[model samples]
Target: MVDIAKVTTELLLEETKTSGHSPLKFICNDGYLYYCKYLVDFDPNEINCLAYEIVSHYLLKVLNIPTPDIALVKISEGTLDKSKIIKNRRLCVNHICFGSKGIDPSEELTEFETCSSKRDYNRILNQEDVVKIALFDLWINNVDRGRFINPGFNYNLLTVRSGNKRKILAFDHAFVFGGVEQIGVFNSKMPFINQDKFHDSDFYKSFISYMDEEEIIKIVENFIPLLKISHKEVIDAAIYQLPDIWKLTPNLANRIQEYLFCEERIEKVKTVILNSKSIY
Candidate 1:
């Protein structure tokens, strides 16, 4: 279980151009820099974005995928400059917000637009995790990661370098479950499947060009057993962590739980990966 802690923002640094919820960077009382997403004032729909982010963060943890550490950051009054209109909306003050620990000496996958270098892949110590991240994206119906949809190719990935190696940390999941705007349309009967476009993107292909089909298959096949285990506790814990003040619909939370843990859906995803020749 994630020990979600509450911390206060100490100082505002800068607002990032990260797509959708353009989170601002701030130094928290924990003494760590975080990319914080604020609950926009007067926008109830913004709750969906924060809910998706927290749920996805826990789901990734259940899958053992690496991601930034999370916290519930309290944005005190006067924390934001009145002149700044951030996230295309007024920032909420004296409210709890979502925060992801900042990674320094790191670069986003977007930085390497279309890397075709084996050296780049070699630098990533956990390259096999690319396969896991691809599957996770499909399960969540994430549209923001690798595809150039309406938001336009927001990779939402960060890589940290340590000496000669690096590790990939997948972040920014506000657009998952068919996106924050489409929350009203989601239901238990709705299919949550999407083509694992993260696997098809040029950046993804470049990383695995050296990996043979069997090796990729091993990485994928290994995940099915883990998926077979019931994640009820994780799902419930994630939903329960969301503050009531956020006002996310209970129905949407239930649908997300059903969509992610359905037995039939898991089988379908497994079959799609094995039959679609996605390992190539």
Candidate 2:
């Protein structure tokens, strides 16, 4: 139902420049603001960027994570053929920022740095925080990806308002699926389990800790219904655009279905979340 015909490269550039990120703005015809990051080289005929953004937003919402808003858009002066344009079909946009506050982490961690670290299985994530983040990732099917490298912040630590303590907002989800280099793996290359590192650094240990197992379960159970709803919406949208999308990446059609229906090891996750929550 995204109106791809309405989008133009010039309009995309204009909206992007205004948003303050890289020179890309995501404006939806339905009236929403989306921050974008171009992964592949920019091209006029390419519409997959809009598709990924739409699906990611939809999935995150389903998982009950505090993600940004999203919608489809049309550009006034696009580079694609005008006659092939479909009204209300084509490009979509994500339009949500948790708040106006910006993040300032004390340390910086790059994608490359994480990958080069020594393998340490004992240094696992705190169960509770992992659960929260995992829930977020699972809903969005951000498989094989990690929270540490999310571009929304300079680092992975969640930020909050100093006065009111409002939930921190993060955006720029255009890279949910594996890119040209790593087709299927989602998480960053850093090892997930590292007990030695966790014990050595209080800050690192605390970051992984959670509230309680019961509390973690509550959060997960609460998100199940939302996930179901989100899955349906995405499936419907993907089905409608299956023909066009298949032409771009045939694997996506099958992957989407597998991700939606896959059986997650929920009980094990609950144990981890509960144990981590007990750390503090």
Candidate 3:
């Protein structure tokens, strides 16, 4: 798990003025703005949103993936107008929360398509990054990487471009671990070793063609730190970081942390993703 920084939202900057599920935008006293994934939702009885975000952020960092800086912030009551947040993900009156560093609007970040269509998708994604993303998604069972086809998807594959230079800072993992639709099945969700649907996942299917076992191993080796950290330590950190409101139990944290750092499960995920590619 990452050493998640803590902050107090000094100002609520911009919010999801649209109809989709987007993070709340705000500025901290440090003058750095952040887009926080709130830790306040437990109503749908589906996802442990805060735990999911914290774990996903930590894993991505360990894997050397490019992502915005992450931190936990305490939002005092009345600091933010709860109405501004998207429906169902309302802000808490007084809560310790977690989220990622925000990207400034002036940065001109843009979104792109992510699909199997060769004509419009080929030039937009980097093969190496794409493969890494595939491996990561397969391991995490992330479901919302490219929900671009849906209307008002808000953010999809957000990217940055600057005069012949480009980069992608990844964020938004709300759908990890089967997400809301499959939340009922999280009790049995074993993504690391499960192959039934990973081969068909957009994050895996679109990029597996460019990958082989050797490349997959290299990516896994690059992320060795993920295994280096003890699972117990991860669970402990998660427990310590999350506020009491979310009610994420240690057992549930253990449930989520299981197999994430297991070597055997990692290899299984790699095998499934590699086997997805036809050798013809």
Best by TM-score: 1
RMSD of each: 2.5, 10.5, 4.7
lDDT of 1 by residue, 1-280 (tens): 8567788888888877754677888898889998888755365776788878888888888888999888988887667654555563556677778898888778887734654677776778887787788778777778778776543355778888888998888998987887765776765467655553576666776667756667778978898777767776776777787777777776766677777767776777666555434444
Q: Per-prediction TM-score, please?
A: 0.89, 0.51, 0.72
**Per-residue lDDT value at 7 in model 1:** 88
Q: Candidate 3 overall Cα lDDT vs. reference? A: 0.59
Question: For candidate 1, which ten residues in a row score worst on lDDT?
Answer: 271-280
Which regions of candidate 1 deviate over 4 angstroms?
Answer: 40-43, 149-152, 275-280
Write the residue-wise lDDT of candidate 3 on 1-280 in tens digits.
4466888888776675432345677788677887765534445353366677777777777666766777877786556865565552556656665657766542422333234555433444444555566567767777655444343222334455544545555676767777666553564335343533334544445545545657665765565445446666655675666666676644666666664656666776666545556631
Query: Which segments of model 3 are wrong by more than 4 Å?
Result: 17-20, 39-47, 82-89, 105-127, 147-156, 181-231, 261-264, 276-280
1 or 3: which has the higher TM-score? 1
Q: Pick the lDDT winner.
A: 1
lDDT of 2 by residue, 1-280 (tens): 3322222222332322221123234343434443333322334223344455556545544454554444333234442232432332233332221111123331223332221222221232223333455545433434223433233222223433343223433344444444223343333232233222122233333443423456666766765444443265455564354234223444554565555443352333334434554554
Clashing pairs in 3: none
Worst 10 residues of 3 by lDDT: 105-114
